[model samples]
Target: MASNNTPVSAQQPTMRRVLKMSEDEIKKQIRSTHNQTKQKLDFDPFYLFDVVKNILNPSIIVVDNIVQGKAKDMEKGNQGESSPKACFIPPCMLKRLSYEMACKVPGEEIAYETTISILRNVLSSYPWHVKAVLTLASFALDYGEFSHLADQIDSSDQLTKSLGILKQVPIVLGRQGVEKYKNSFGKLNTLIKLTLDVVECVVELEKRIDGNNTKDVPELSLAIENMSIDVFWTIITVVDCMSRICALINDKNNTQELLPFTGKITSILKSLTDQIAVCDRQIAEIKAYLKFKRDLESLQDIVEFFKKLIFVEESHNLQQATISNNELSKKTEGLRKKKVLLFFSDFDISEKVVSILKPICEEESRKDQYEIVWIPIVKNWTDIVQSKCKVNEKYFWYVVRQFSSVLGIKYVKEQWGFKDKPIVVVLSSEAKVEHKDAFHMIQTWGIEAYPFTFERERELRNREDWFGSTIDFIPDVLTWMKEEKYIFLYGGEETWIKKFEDEATKVTNDPDISSEEISIKLFNVGKTCKAKDYLGIFLKNLNKLFFSKSQKETELDTKTKEIQMLLSYMNDGEGWVVLCKGHKLVFSGNGTKVVMALKSINDGKQGLHKSTEIQVLLKQRYNEIILPVTCCKFTANTNSGWVHGDCAKCPECSQIMEMIINFKCCHKGHPTKAVP
Candidate 1:
């Protein structure tokens, strides 16, 4: 007996050691023992509820603590610690946990009630935790569990309690709260879909009740009606808040400062809420009207029907008229201009008119002067027929109809006496007819003659003596070029030079001018050459010519000024029609002018000094011609081909050369062998 007691005393130390072990270690040991037994804990319907209540409840408490400002001390305590400050269960995690719990005990009322209670606690404490509440609600609704809860909420007392919780949600969460938890909620599609499902369900139930006897379970029907309205408004509020928040988030300038602009956002939300309230009132009125229609009182029902019919018709007509008026005002405002040139024509004539008018109309300087309104005289029968058939068309004649209606085409036609298909009616700034003969002007002088015609008409109206050809002579280019001594033809096209040379040869070979006295120099100004530099030189010489005249007391005549004006145009670098020592420009052409000028010089009608003019002409032409020749084609070689130039010397020899091509020769005043 003494030996057995000694062994029992030894077991006391082992038992004390087991008692000293931590609770976690003890639980691990029990779990290990339980696993070894190969036995399972029987499934309990309340197991999920227990799990949520134990595991998720603490997280909700922490969230509540944070929302209530009670966790600040804890946050400060763990600020510098290497360990994590506090347990942070994200709203998404909370949502997932709630969903799992709901899924586990799907059909259990106690499970659903527990979930709702937990979610309500979380929401009430931290009202911005909208995602968690929505998630729990979605789980219940999706699983058909909410319908069970709805059925159980039979008494008005139960319904009112439930409504109380729902009512607080919108008040506490508000628009800002919804915006705060939007990201945590992820896509709102699921929430919106759940809301729609609930609303649809309530609607279907109401329809079924209305289809059958409505008196039975009147409380349930009333409760469902209230639920539908509340749920519908909730959906609207959520969607509106989310949409506004998303818009703000998308704005680059507002994204970082969304919180700072809360006041503005709140104002916008208030406006939206007011609009929703209006919709709610409208819905209630519609529901009342529908109920009134179903009432058994036949006389009252008929009276109500007539009232609704009249109201609907009046609303529709008023809305349509308002829209039409707005559109008409916009069109009228857009078409209103200071001055307009309204042209009316058939399709073919309109196309022709547009082609002619496009150039003048597109000029930037003319934009502010007047507006062009083209109206096709042809009726758009195709568009009219299509419009009757409910098909859309944008035919040119449709625009004509619109304009004709807007501007009173009949009155305009009568006032302007425009009986012709193609006619132009110019309206003044006051929309009064200023010119009715615009079509004739366009036909006579083309679109370029517009505004000029208008100006001329103004002058006529004022009874001012027409400034007949502003400055006397338009200076016949032929007469001006003939007076010049030299003819310098500059052009990029070799064909131009060839034509001129052929014509010049004809002119030189005439009995009046000796072939020996003729001189022709060719310059190939290729595409790469700076033709502008030559233009600049011409401009500088013209400036000198103008200033030289100022030195003389006698003022230049109209012809001389016209000639100078013509010369000023040569700076365009199109082609030079230089004359009289290459200092003057008569005009630009494909050297046709030069050939004519040369012919005229030989004709001796202008009384030009032949010897002095020819000498100065040859000197200037040769000097100006050398620059392009040296830059483009000239190379130092005696075998270079000769060109036609009588009395021209070879650079290598003092002997008079003939057929000197680009001043190149055989070095002995003979043409190269390469020359034909």
Candidate 2:
């Protein structure tokens, strides 16, 4: 019954000495009991508290009803019958513990140290929370029964009056009723609640620790150390409450005699409440740390998978290669659950590959779904290597920090089919190879080739609508299509491009050939034009149609035929032109023929006001045109695996064309030119 008025520190030295001795003695009893038992005594302290909580803290509502002369009404409403959750502790064990604690609760005056010593010996074999629970329960039994009989002691029933008098409930309550001792009852009830809270925190701490090693967590270890003292004080408070109640029942006015014990219990309650908060924080921190550790382990597993995929020899210095960029390891976590593009190249990474991926990586909507790691194959990390890496950094929109030389050139060539040219190898989250060389697909579709698997490539091929798919990404073309304007896409060398642009401008502006209904837009989409990325994608897609593994010339579908026609015009290194109206192909021909056809249409037709009339005349003129013979060689990387056909039809004249294979090797900084 410790009160707020008496501080624990202000106690006399003699009392302090006695408390120190009591603490040591109590610990000895606990250890001796543990050794004698040799096994943990199982009990449900929380369930035991629930069974006796109301008994220890009688309802204020019931007291109010009794004072209002409505005791019968209250009794009728409260049949006192309740079905609590099943208790796991054995009935025999509970009864025995109750008897032991009841016996330990002294009736007459005794020293605080002696009372605690006697109670500790009784509860020595039990856990700290269980000991506190049992003591409170023992007091609850007597106190509850006393209150019940006292409430109905005035009844005509002789049995009730006799029991109330036998337990001295009448004297305890006084002529003024139990309200006369409300202060004492309140103090006892608060102490009981504080004791339960301490028990709950201790139980939670033990559950958190379980059988895990607390050595790594200093907070958990320190909280465990403080628990022993916290539990000891809790048991002391419970025993004092029992004594205080006994004093109240024996003689109401004699409660003053137990003031010192009450004050001690009150102080113990405050101290225990404060310590519970500390324990809670310690447990919380441990939980957070454990969660973080698990997450880190998951990320490390991914890093190791990447290392195994690229690192050829176990003796190779992974730390040196990866740690060169500290951000490499930190950002690897982003690769989890994402398709990773392992960009493998020599010191010279082709601008084609970077340009294709640059816009894809910088796309705000879908960038997070994939990651790219550049694995530069080099003999050693010399100044040349460092310089190359720095130069490539600006081009790499999403620069993955892991640029290591562990993936030697020979390994990439043998294992991944990477030739002198750079290749993008797409890997699924599990590190399984999805696409060996996804560069072709990426070059064709950009971000649409996400996951960059062969399956995705096939899916794009299956859904190909050449005219629509080609210009679907161009907003201006889409608008022109909606307006039913004639759209022309032309590509070529600089000289051919200039001639095509001049002829297209003359046809659109000249009043003699131009029609108000036939609106025309000409785009310069040459390999060296501002929109080279667009031309590159269109060429890669056209190549797929020409050299598709699943289809031949006779088996070629309508879309394939259309794409082959465009490819034929560009294969000779000549300018090419394609005309469409609202996703419908109007005409496609060699750039030279297209320019000549436009000029012919302009010279012959004057004030042509109909689009159909202009289209029919333009097609006739284009068909009648021919240019000088030139090389129609279609050069492609044989390593890309997309090239399948050795022969292809000339879509312009429907003639079979021969395919040639050539090979040449050169040292760094020198590239061999093909002999015409």
Candidate 3:
């Protein structure tokens, strides 16, 4: 056989050998191509379909040495249905190609949202089938992408849509068709996993569809419910197909040796089942919550109560206000400006009247000619009225004794109510009034006293019910606030505040005043601003003040031109607003006859006077009226400075009636003693 030329060299690669590749080389080629398709397609179904469309063509694969099939046309490995008529590619070949793709697709990277959106949108356009979605989901698990798959499938809005979709992917899969040939693509672990996954998905989808009958759970409310249904279906499909793959491991005539193939199959199933169960438990809680939602209607009353409190308690605020309107000056134009020396019994009028007086002096429209005795130890009418309830008297002499302190006054306390009490007298004659800054006294000429007013004891019985109202206060406060000429008192008499007290500090007190309509568009502001209705005092005193000012203006007591011009305001009704008792306007009298009530008691007595001689005699001459004596002094007998009985002085001519005097012109005169 070794003939000439050592004939024929060592045999080169034979024709058959040239046509074939080594097992390792074949795997590398398949694996390299696998990575390329998977990278491009990713989780994109349309993209994968496109890749299949591009790379797969007739004659690309040969079956039994005949080039009559595409790569997807290989059915020896397919586990499920045949290819779509459009695809013309067998499902077995598609499974092999897809397995190779998913195996190469790494497990680490997978974003569910992108894949899910594409799947849902693709379904909307082409078909209502869940088949493609389940297939993609199967591929995901092959690459450890179950979570990504679950996330996407759970997008079904309601259980209705989810179950409806689950119904399409086969649940109790036929044991004969795809299941019989699932392991044809042997040794590629990902391929077997993918086949098993698809089958199980179909089954669990069937269970979800079946679970709908109980109607126990709602639409997919939680993340877990959707996952359990979807993944449970996936696990069953995997288990069933993988069971066939288990047999393939023993038949090991194949090119690959997937070590522990059965274990991988079982381990994956365990992982998926456990994950699905966890999802089920989580969803169970969500369902329970949905079934027992609380009734919101029970809290309606309580909510309303707090809403009202929000207005009453929180909206309530204390606001210091200043006197804005100059009705005081305008109304009392013709009145003489003189100092008033009050002889209070138990009444304290200082605190109540101080606020009114500060504005009167600081008012831009007033002439500051008089000063008020800012008297102190001023009696509070309430304290005085509440002082007496005698413990024992057979007929109750203590009743009037209690009211003896009631000086017939009306007032509002910052801490109490607005009640009309009697005018109270001064408990202390020593007025610390001058101590309260004579300069502050110089600003306005009147004292504010809210003490019990007992000045008129008889009338107190008839006017017990007279008080104030706030309805007419808007116009008065508005007039003062609009001009920036108000008196705000942040503190009491100890720290009486004038309108312009802080020269450099800006006015922080916001007097919210309406420039228009008197009472209609009103807003509540400032604490002290509330009880603004002093109508009772003003109305009762209005006509007396109005008529008197008119008479005084015409008569001209000062006999000066400036006084005449100033008093002219009294002749008009503009001056009457301040004196109008908005508080006392009851059903007692109508507008016309109300003016007559203001006429002074001295009205009827004034007719007896003619000239200076008659006034002098009436004031000086003894008229036989017994006078209560001021305390007496001991002239000769003195002990511890105690005094009793009074010293009599002549009322007529500045002469002591009981003391000796020489001049007859200065002698004490009796009413009958006619002096020439």
How do the predictions measure up, each by TM-score?
0.21, 0.38, 0.19
Residues 1-676, candidate 1, lDDT per residue (tens digit)?
0011123344445434533456455334322222222222232212222232232223333333333434323342222213322442223444543443432211112222343443334322321113223433334332222222222233357664475344233222224533554342223323433333333333334344444333323343443334322332332233332332233233322321111122322433444344434444444443443444343223323223222222222121112111122333334334344455666654444445555565556656766666665554433436654343222112221132333231133333444444434567675554445666465445433444557345644333222211111111113222333343334344435565566566555544554345335333333322243334443333333343333333332665443353343342232233333332222332232233444455555544332335445534432332332111111111111111222222245577644343312222234321111000
Candidate 1 vs 3: which has more TM-score? 1
List lDDT for all candidates, in order.
0.36, 0.58, 0.27
Better of 2 and 3 by lDDT: 2
Among all candidates shown, the one with the greatest lDDT: 2
Q: Tens-digit lDDT track for model 3 on 1-676?
A: 1111211122123312422435454333323222222122224343333333222221112111121112233442232233434443323323542342331211101112222333333222322113334344334333222212222232455654354234321111112212422334323334444434433433443344445422333332322233333332332233333332333322323322222334434554565455445445434543432322222112233223211211111111212112222432233222233222222122233344434444443444323433222211123325434332111112211111222111121111111111122111221122212111122122212322212122222122124122222222346434543333322211112121221133102211112122221221112122243455333323323322222234324553321221122122222222111111233212121111112212211222332223222223222322223333221111111111122112333356532233221112233332221111
Candidate scoring better on lDDT of 1 and 2: 2
lDDT of prediction 3: 0.27
Which scores better on TM-score, 1 or 2?
A: 2
Q: Please give the TM-score that candidate 1 achieves against the real structure.
A: 0.21
Q: Highest TM-score: which candidate?
A: 2
lDDT of 2 by residue, 431-542 (tens): 6677777776677677787768978876766563346556555667778877877878888788888888887888878664343645788765554545547777666555
